[model samples]
Target: MMIHRLGTMLLLIGIGALPAQSQVAPLAPSDITNIPPDPALKNWSVRTVQIPMRDGVKLNTIVILPRGIKNAPIIFARTPYGAEKALTGAPSNDFRLALPTSYADLAAAGYIVVVQDVRGRYGSEGDYIINRPLVGPLNDTKVDHSTDAYDSIDWMVKNIAETNGKVGTIGVSYGGLTTLYSIVNPHPALRAAVPINPLVDGWMGDDWFHNGAYRQSFLDWVYRMSADKSSKYALQFDRQDVYESWLKAGSVSDMAKQLGVDTMPMFRKLVDHPAYDEFWQLQALDKRLGKEPLKVPTLHVHSLWDQEDIYGAPAAYAAMEPKDRGNDENYMIIGPWRHGQGMVADGSKLGAITFNGNSASWYRQKVLIPFFDRNLKGSADPGIAPVTAFETGANEWRRYDRWPMSCASGCPSRSKPIYLSSGGGLGWTSPTGAGGFSEYVSDPARPVTYRQRPILGTYNPLTTWGQWLVDDQRFAEARPDVVTFVSEVLTDEVRLAGQPIAKFFASTSGTDSDWVVKLIDVYPAEYAEAPEMGGYELAISMDILRGRYRESFSKPAPIPANQVLPYEIKLPNVSHRFLKGHRIMVQIQSSWFPLYDRNPQKFVPNIFTAQKSDYQKATQRIWTSARYPSRIELPVMP
Candidate 1:
């Protein structure tokens, strides 16, 4: 009876009428297939091809040619992300808009842009290994990123119709890693390389881990990358607050299992090897690239507030500097950017902090473009210095003959110790009193969140991952588990141009612990300029060190319970000025929350596999005295 009533209703509505069928008729072949070309893309020619590697694997490559191009040099980029999307996703008559924003100046300068998908990603063929190690001890396979890069360059120079055979490699993050790999056994046509925020060492400081503390947030990325060749999938969460999600997920291993990423090779390796083992050491790009003399003119771009891969640019530059005997081939650009923002966005401001001008645009037009023209196009001198750094507080750029003249090997920079004293004070002089310590109770159950609560996923559109480095530190300073040591208002500006070393005469009641040190710039309480920034605590440089690996990064051992020990934490490089009327601050804590996996406090063989019971509250102490003066050695610029 219900079926009969439904049929009568359909007949009354004329659901299958002849006129309705005509209205829903399929589009004509010409109407569907022959669409007018975008007027905006009229000046650009875009095409894709499968370029074969030495191993017979075909990588999907996109070649973009500018209008009326002739004898043009090639700007090449290899990436795991989709080449088609990166190179030609947006169709525009303006060549600058046709490519990534970072390459805008180069795009206007008229060069053949080539982008390709690395093996086993996107449209490329072959198994994808995250940061595939070079063909050496760690990887017995002949096909690696370096080899693939060599083959790709060889193919491009030989097959492309462009007259000029010169090629320059440039990319950021993973793509930046590929750019570095290209210079390993560079192709004859390869002239220049720009590795911006490249992934150099995973276990030491880059992605995955920083000084043995795992960045568990990267698990979502791993799951997405390894799930399939396409970028369609994303890790979903039942809760919007990632801090809560991670806290409730228990151990890193448990998180992996719950996400069902435990079976992935990358996740398994991360879980299996929590320490800096041979697996990681052998894959370090700096160690590998530094072994040979510099073959290509390379420019290393480092972001001052690079939330990810902060240690890579300087580390790689330091390793390769000695090889550049003439000092003309190796160059470094340090910008006030978060990750790849230097190339991708207007660098006028970050968060609430504003640079006087568009720093990124200036860098691209004045520095990056000229660098490429000199090496790739055989242009005259661009007058680029060995080090081009953006001074944060000063809101300007400075040229230096060499970088970190105060801290690097055989450099002239002096290391001035700023002692952490009692009463939450920081001073240039050593403490004269007897041994005294500042104490805090570190509980794993309530690990301090790296940022304010309701932290989003690493790659989430609304995630603070990019700007968190420059985020105000007042949130962390307000916590009880976190200890703050602030200096008196400066009478004169204090400039720092190199790495800051934190010397902690510290101890933990438990057998294991973690130490997080932050160097901050405290603004004045009352200010006319940017009133909202009043009393802001801006972190200049910060890093974490797992206590087990304090003695040796490769080895892990438990701390002596309740015993005083000296741990040296090397903070990332910085170029900043503590303006007069401002204060210098240092905040030390045991946990950076789900950002870095919580230290069990109770020593376990492997933190990844540790049980919930392994986590406990421990009394952590920081000693200050003439004999054991806990201080941060700042590379104060003369």
Candidate 2:
């Protein structure tokens, strides 16, 4: 039975004979290829090929055969991540093995699948360069990602004689990034592609940088642990706390001794460059920002709560000019998930919330298999109206032709701002009567700690993926050590799409003070239910914004403690159908722990080097009004 994929249905409706139900068979790893496979699909052979790249670097690749046939349609996945069967392919239904998935999924579907390890990591050859060194005055010898992807495709096209020549790429995370990178190059053989949770763009500003201010709670450092190599520095230092731990554990001398000369150079360099600089130039992947818009069809599957690359995915997708976003060639799917894996960011249990199903299953059944079935097999696959996303709070899937907004004729005339009045609530008018701005003393010595603790497999000390974002204001609520801001109840549903920006006008008594803004959807009642196991949501959903690069990310300077400084940070992209009976809420604070590190009240050269004595609590003031109202601006869709 064939499913009416996105294309076939569009074709049928074009010819007019359409009252049909979609046919879909949820695929399982066991259903992949049986050494002989079930006679249903067809026969295929396997071949091993070595692909060479620029400068003579070679990558080991595997080609899946189709019924011993020659020159058939080929599907490609160029990945630096290995394609080891036991580790890479699909696992048992119970996931008794590693990841229950593999290249077999594609091969079994009747398409010839080609898999390769990226240069330097697995079987591929070449010196790994996470921070590609500046060899010449301007260029770096280390082969960049673009050249790598381009070279791999060239090899597949010329050497892989049986491949009908057409190739489509797919992968998650690193592979996803490569897929996105591949299309930018305009390769003739590469036509259709899927970049699942691709690390598309923005290293600093996304989750790691958070508008120039680093997300302490995010474990960007530990990832250094698994970079191109497991070297002395990579092993000795936990990227998450090298700066802070070195200062606290008094391990500088030991660290310097352990990392010696060769290792610590790069880690130390990053600390010094704090803001976006030349160091991030060759290292960041988003450099391909405006590369020629795709000439072929594409499917970009990204996760919303993904700890690693959410910022890049949506930012890159939304950044496309209208001209570049034409046709079904480019489709975007974002699930409430963390990093490159899983669909729902939440396992459905946030302190008290729980979602029953795993997003991967749905993604496999509804999106993955069906998508390929339509494009490759020319089968009848369902249109895009099916599995767009499950509104976590509402418990349902909503579909639209495009993301961000649903057909914006012109920013809705109904746009309005809900002001933050006195008494910690929102209203239409500026609560001048609520008096002046509230203040908090930020102390570096006894700095308010970020509540997140270390988890088992967490490489970064402050990785806050899969945590709670509730009203935990009791500790900092009236404390002089924290800043607070609140908005009034909304009279109507502020349907929103796109990203939110939290702008703050603040002054600190110390050289530096961390500022965070959160946009909350205040629900109607304490709608707590055993079925909705995830705590309370009369509080709805929330997102945060940090302040450090208020002026710019490249430079850092103290605010002289009390002088006011205005800063704005970009929050994550969101799609919420805030109902009419709900209220729009926003909160501002200086600290959000284990998820982020504590900001010692003092303005020191580095956050990690500050001492307990330097943690003197300083006063913080927030300014608001129609003129500079510290606000949360969202993309309101119809």
Give the best candidate by lDDT: 1
**Local accuracy of candidate 1 as per-residue lDDT tens digits, 468-545:** 888888989888999999999999998899999999789899999999999999999987788999999999999999
Q: Model 1's lDDT to the true fold?
A: 0.88
Off by over 4 Å in 1: 1-33, 38-41, 87-90, 406-411
Q: Per-prediction TM-score, please?
A: 0.94, 0.75
Backbone clash pairs in model 2 (N, Cα, C under 3 Å; residues 3+ apart or in different chains), count:
62
TM-score of 1: 0.94
Count of backbone clashes, every candidate in sequence: 3, 62
Candidate 2: C-alpha RMSD after superposition: 16.7
Over the stretch 76-175, how does candidate 2's per-residue lDDT look in tens digits? 7766556544234333322222223444455545567777766665666776544332233334474666667677777877877776677777877767
